[model samples]
Target: MTLIGRTHAREIETLSLDSADTRNALSAALVGELADALTDCAGDAGVRAVVLTHTGSTFCAGADLRDPPHPDALVGLLRQIVTLRKPVLARITGHVRAGGLGLLAACDLAVASTRSDFAFTEVRIGVAPAVISLTVLPRTDPRALARHYLTGARFDAAEAVRTGLLTAAGDDVDAVLEPILDGLRRSSPQGLAETKQLLTAKVLEAFDRDAADLTALSARLFSSPQAREGMTAFLERRDPSWAV
Candidate 1:
């Protein structure tokens, strides 16, 4: 079964995260499939842009605890999105949390419906949003993100845009995306690629400088005693012992 559903229209390719049962979590399989799909998009001349979206109430609920990908793989996936020659945009209409925010930040543009909400939930699971910080820290406002990062508090679409996690938000997600898609369809392929390269230079730089350290941090924390307790509490639907 495919975790990503692909569709193309005009000059854009839409990749929908389709594992609604897992809230489209970043399992190793899902990450591999998405990377492969993006590579195909990069090589296809007919595809001028890529839209990353989801098919459920939650866009992505972070990494799949049952089958999480390696920290290195996640970092590579995030870097791939940032470095993909074709522009990648995110279209969200639901909740996004933890590692999902990394994917959003990696995209060139992201828009969502007002109904969507976001959070960096790794703290609740006794893990840092470490590897993802490679993409996230570069795109977001540090002052605003500090609170969310520490508390794992939920914020709305408007707040996401203000913090630089999303480009725009409205009551109607598709309506908000139409003009943006039209603009991408109108732009020359070479123009878009070069412009995207300019925009992502600093983000790529962050990946080069910090990805290894962050990936190590992520692996360490996830394997720690605190994370074990936290994950157990989460799976049991109870507050972690340290929650107090």
Candidate 2:
């Protein structure tokens, strides 16, 4: 079965992460499919806005540890979302973690349910949020990032908004998102595209300059003994040996 599903209505295309069994983890297959969908939406004149969302309680649990890291694919997919001619909106209804925050940051706008939670969990797994920091660091509050990135603590949707990770959060996601989508639909495609470029120029430049270095850092960390033990401990439902 396909890991990503697409639906369209009123010039808005919704790309749903369908891998609920994996909590919509960013497996290589899922990332590839999402990139393809975004590319299709970018070229479709009927599509004016794209909504990135999921079907399960966990929006995305981050990268799948069962497989090797796909930093290039993840970076490419984020680039596609950021550069797509259409404005992309993240419709978050559940928890987000680690690499998933990268995807969320790449969107032009994001609305999350107040019930949702978020974290930069890489440090706990003995890896740094290297690649994702390219997108996330620009948008998040420096103080908040220093705390969350170092502690791997979970924060609620309201904090996510206050930190600039989310555009808005409320008990009703659709209530918050529909109006933004409506505003986007009213905007001319050229207007949205140009405005998005102006907004994302720094992020795009960071990607161009630091993507390779960050990917290498990620690979090194993931392959380290500490990360191996950390991930193994997580899968086994225990703390890593290094945990004090």
Candidate 3:
């Protein structure tokens, strides 16, 4: 776990999710570390841009289901990123799926390698991608979300870009990252902060009301028979007819 911040070409902060074996799952510890790091970066006057890249072959596999943190803990970390003043960039190089995609969706800018993949596997695990809905839903088209949410399907870099989740999908990791970093440098740090604030303001406005809706929806969703049936069917290698 490394959160390094500096000022040279620009104010920069990076989250080094160095858990190679876990592919950088958002465990409680990691989320705590990230929350602290993001705060440090946002607080620094010199830091203009942020690069959120991970170590090893994969970017992040989301959260390890073995220990899903308390909803407050996980949502707390995301709320920081969502409200951060500095621009944040997600630099992806390898496989991204399930909760990993949720983390990427939190970033304002995503630059992924051509070889990388994007997937939402929550439904397959018998749960919906509810937390990520706030970040990804607004970015993705209605039809695309409908398709992906229905099947918990996998899509590649191109589809990710077309769906508006990724800003640039390049042939490799370095190529994808360079332009984004450069673009951030060229823009005014103050302007970036203002724009980010504007975005955050709008998101937060809806978020307060929508959060209540999400809690209600998730409570009903998890407690319902449909969720149990869906989980069983998924484990049994069959389809779920939720509307049934």
Candidate 4:
């Protein structure tokens, strides 16, 4: 199924990655759907907040590396999420890895279940976490960031929260999501828009002004020897030497 976008009368908009059969891999079609949904949500006067989520067990296993969509697409989506003009939240369930960390990190708030897991696994796959790392680094613990991107270690939701990748670990995922939606509902729509813009400016303005440099950065990283080695190791089911 394609990515599904839904908005409620309560002013909560959700964009769900709906290809549950493939673990919701971010393919070209899915990313395009997501981008369109984001644009719609951004322009909607009634949307107070957005909750980004996926349909099943894995929140997202990252981009579809097998005939994956254009590399530029991931960066573009990241930029869209960063520049969107409303509060965005991430609801995490299980086994989030690689660019999934970027998805979690992109949002203003992330709520995870205690059983959920998170990892920045790009380095293990022979690629730098170049696309998502820029936004994630500030929201995460420097040491945890050090371990994650380097080791590709998966930590629990509690650890995710401690590392600032998550705001809280909820006992009941749906229950927690309700209050979060309600809390967002209380904020004035105008205030939410302005706040979102300010938040983006604070984090992205310093370096990513036009996202021009990002292409260079991603190209260098994706083509590096390290990226090749890491991705090969992952496909072969082995630990990457990058950790050693």
Candidate 5:
């Protein structure tokens, strides 16, 4: 079954994460499908911009415990988003957690509804937000990320924008994105691609310098004892032994 639903109109392509059954978790198949779709968008001259959105209440709930993608694959997917020639924008109106924030950060622009909430949930699962930091650290405020990364607390859309996680948030997400999409529609394809490259240089640098280390770290942590206990407890709907 297809996990991504695609639609295009007026040169704008919309890719929706359609795996609501798993809360659109980053399963291996989902990741691979998304990567291929993105590559197609990147090569299509008729596609002016891409909108990454989701079908369910949760935009994404991080890596799928049942069928997670390899750490290296996750890193590559994030890098692809950061380096995609045409602009990629995230249109969110739901909760985002853990690795999903990495996807949001990789996008050139992100807008969400005021109702959306976000959290870095990796720490609760006995893993750091290691792989995601490549794109996230480059995009967000260090101090804000420090607190959220360590505590795994939930923050609202306004706080997300203040911390540079979101470009804007509003009562109506579509209303918020319309003007931005109009601007993109007006922009020359070459102008958008070149400007996006100029904007994403530092983000790509982070991927170049730190991706290998972070991917290794993520793989190690996910295989460790603590993560096993955390995952088990999470599936069982109980607290891990480390929880107070």
Candidate 6:
């Protein structure tokens, strides 16, 4: 299964991406399963919060370029997470890249291991981070976004926090997350829901306004000649022709 869904404490729901074989890559199937799981959690009043997590060393290696890319699916999933009535927390235990960073940005809060790394790598593959920019650009530091989005350089968790992609980074992610979860548990469900709406109004507007165009842009870029060669070279473990 690409995703595993479970509820604990009668209130905390966890939807873990389990496609370790692909480093939990955002295949259409995985994204669909995630969307379904999140929808189920959203409609269940017993579920007060959702934890987005993954198994294996790589949290998510962006899109599975070998398969058809479905940028709309990712865009919808990010929207779902951001607009969810209950709080969504990302638990990162490993490396995150490209589209995965968008997932981190969507969550209301994220706690990552100090060893975890991140990058916005779409540009390296001849495509831009179009759809993700809707959510990521709102949270990321403008200067950091300019440098990392263009260079695709790997950055550490501390920088992730400083740039607003994460709430905290530590040796023990669970320890860092416990306090946040406890605080969430104390809030009334109605209060959380209303507060979340206040916090996410701008993001919802951005999604409504920009998702379609960005999704189209992502689709076009992925199908471009340069992207084809870049993806091919990446899968073959070689540098693209344009690499300096």
Instruction: Give the TM-scores of the predictions, in the order they appear.
Output: 0.99, 0.98, 0.84, 0.88, 0.99, 0.97
Model 3: per-residue Cα lDDT over 34-69, one tens digit each: 787888887788788778888788787776654555
Alpha-carbon local distance difference test for all models: 0.94, 0.91, 0.74, 0.77, 0.95, 0.89
How much does candidate 1 score in TM-score? Answer: 0.99
- The regions of model 3 sitting more than 4 angstroms off are 1-10, 215-244
Q: What are the RMSDs of all candidates, in order?
A: 0.6, 0.8, 3.8, 2.4, 0.5, 1.1
lDDT of 5 by residue, 4-110 (tens): 99999999999999999999999999999999999999889999999999998999999999999999899989999989999999999999999999999999999
The prediction achieving the highest lDDT against the true structure is 5
Cα RMSD, model 2: 0.8
User: By TM-score, is 5 or 6 better?
Assistant: 5
How many clashes (backbone N, Cα, C below 3 Å) per candidate? 0, 0, 3, 5, 0, 0
Error at 139, model 1, angstroms = 0.7
Candidate 6 clash total? 0
As a whole number from 0 to 100, the lDDT of residue 161 in candidate 5 is 99
Return the lDDT, model 3, position 90. Answer: 88
Give the C-alpha lDDT of model 3.
0.74
Q: Model 2: clashing residue pairs?
A: none
Over 4 Å off, model 5 = none
Residue by residue across 76-157, what tens digits does model 6's lDDT show? 8899999899999999999999988888899999999999999999888899999889889888899988999999999999
lDDT, residue 102, model 4:
79
